[model samples]
Target: MECFFKDPCFSHEEEYRVVFFQHDIDHNEAKYNQKVLFREKSGIITPYIEVRPLTSSKKLPIQSITIGPKNNVDNAQVGLEFLLIKQGYDSISVERSRIPLRY
Candidate 1:
């Protein structure tokens, strides 16, 4: 389904699928929340991401990541590049985003 999380100044629209799988394990109340996990359409799991809301409503949602911690086997940068290539992303853009603590 298509879900839109938009702001007055910016908008983000994306499609996400949710499925419940049968596993041999007991369920717990703390297992699920509003937490979201993004996966590739090819069924390859990507790195773990933590999305944090901006302090001001004017900014778009920003995500922070810890790459190596999730897949500690290979170099973090190398693993990321491999995953992106497999997913058909030919290029990537890296930008420096910083917010002052006092701001």
Candidate 2:
């Protein structure tokens, strides 16, 4: 069975996620004995592991990024572009949402 699946009924929702594995975790080793970081949210503590994506290139393989419906979408686009360039990520397409968001 597929661990991750996209439902056609919820196509409008952006559900992109990255899963971490043992090999993926092995790549992100530290000089110290530190590995996972624990965080408490809503009185529940969870372990957060650092996983670096395995890509042929150094940059992430995200070709397109969609900005969801929210206030200041134009500003968000500019900020996204700046962040991409600053992070050495290139050849990415930025698009705005068309769905009527009522929030």
TM-score: model 1 vs. ground truth: 0.24
Where is model 1 poorest over a 10-residue stretch in terms of lDDT? 94-103
RMSD of each: 14.5, 6.2
Candidate 1 C-alpha lDDT tens digits along 1-103: 2233433322222223334532326755355433436668458875334544465663333233223223233465666667656755545532222222231
Best by lDDT: 2
User: Please, what is the whole-model Cα lDDT of each candidate in the order they appear?
Assistant: 0.41, 0.72
Candidate 2's error at 32, in angstroms?
15
Best by TM-score: 2
Off by over 4 Å in 1: 1-74, 94-103
Clashing pairs in model 2? none
